[model samples]
Target: MIIKVRLIPTTGRNEVISRIGSVLRVKIKNKKVDDDAANAIMRTFLADFFNVHEESIIIVKGAKGKEKTVEVRDKSEEELRKIMDSIP
Candidate 1:
């Protein structure tokens, strides 16, 4: 599923913040990088969180900004959606 997740890059401890309404707010774990700040980390975190391969998640938009459109491959989309739907 293609979803927009707002990312917050902080100094300590990575965490998935609570979802409020249609927006999924996430605090990105801080990681110093040569390129984009922790985009890879975010992908990896989501992949592990959703129990999917890193290749299965794509940053469809906002690679350099806070709000990102993440594409979780079909192999996990249904599973992802169900889990997301269960969230308040």
Candidate 2:
């Protein structure tokens, strides 16, 4: 499923709040907002949350910004939420 996420960098901790059904508000440490860091975080978040491979999570938008829209195919909203909630 595809989800819209408004990322807040420089946050105290990483978290995910569901907004509506397919949108999420994600907050992450600013130190992880850089290109390499973002990719690593994304991978870890998705893999741990959804129990999927890191390659499954795709950032469809905001690749260079704090806010992003991500596409994680073959997963339902419920599963996505569980995955997101698992993020630390």
TM-score of each: 0.80, 0.65
Per-residue lDDT over 45-76 for candidate 2, one digit per residue giving the tens place of the 0 to 100 score: 75555667777788888887666777786667
Worst 10 residues of 2 by lDDT: 14-23
Q: Kindly list the per-residue Cα lDDT of model 1 for residues 1-88, writing each as its tens digit.
A: 8877777767776667778765677666674422275788888888877778999889888887777788888465567778777655
Range of the 10 consecutive residues with the lowest summed lDDT in candidate 1: 28-37
Measured by TM-score, the strongest candidate is 1
Q: Judge candidate 1 against the unseen true structure and give its global Cα lDDT, from 0 to 1.
A: 0.74
| Candidate 1 residue spans exceeding 4 A from truth | 31-35
Q: How many backbone clashes does candidate 1 have?
A: 0
TM-score of candidate 1 on Cα atoms, chains taken together: 0.80
Per model, state how many residue pairs clash: 0, 1
RMSD of each: 2.7, 3.8
TM-score of 2: 0.65
Residue 86: error of model 2 in Å?
Answer: 12
- What is the C-alpha RMSD, rounded to one decimal, of candidate 1? 2.7
